[model samples]
Target: MSGRRTTHEDAHDPAPTWTPRLGDLAHDSSADRTGVVVEVPGDGVFSYHLRPERGGADPEWTAPADGSTLSPADD
Candidate 1:
């Protein structure tokens, strides 16, 4: 068997462009998570938040933007 551990790769489809994280909000660094990019919404802040959302699903904005603002993606 392949010693390499299994990552969050699709079974039928090929691997996604990005990976998926459980609850990482700050999209500062390109993480191994799935999702596009939203506005940073902050100045002087060298960070961004990425969630499994689209259209209007905004990232966290209050505090700890990457704490618990990640919402589920729609089918």
Candidate 2:
């Protein structure tokens, strides 16, 4: 077999880091939930605030804007 890895082999690899922008929909991998990007303070450890896209009474939550814990939500 070849030493190089194939796409299939990479499928199990960790997801690439994703940077979240304002008004962008992102998924919280750690929380296993989806939310909309509502704020980007650009400071502090948790620099992003995400609100539920469905418009719920649930309060907004904070996340890291560095994409280490967030990914673009799949449509």
Q: Backbone clashes per model, in order?
A: 7, 0
lDDT of 2 by residue, 17-38 (tens): 6668889999988878789988
Off by over 4 Å in 1: 1-30, 54-75
Query: Which stretches in model 2 have alpha-carbon errors above 4 Å?
Result: 1-17, 43-46
lDDT of each: 0.40, 0.80
Q: How high is each candidate's TM-score?
A: 0.24, 0.66
TM-score of 1: 0.24
Question: Which 10 residues in a row give candidate 1 its minimum summed lDDT?
Answer: 61-70
| TM-score (C-alpha, index-matched) for candidate 2 | 0.66
Which candidate number maximizes lDDT?
2
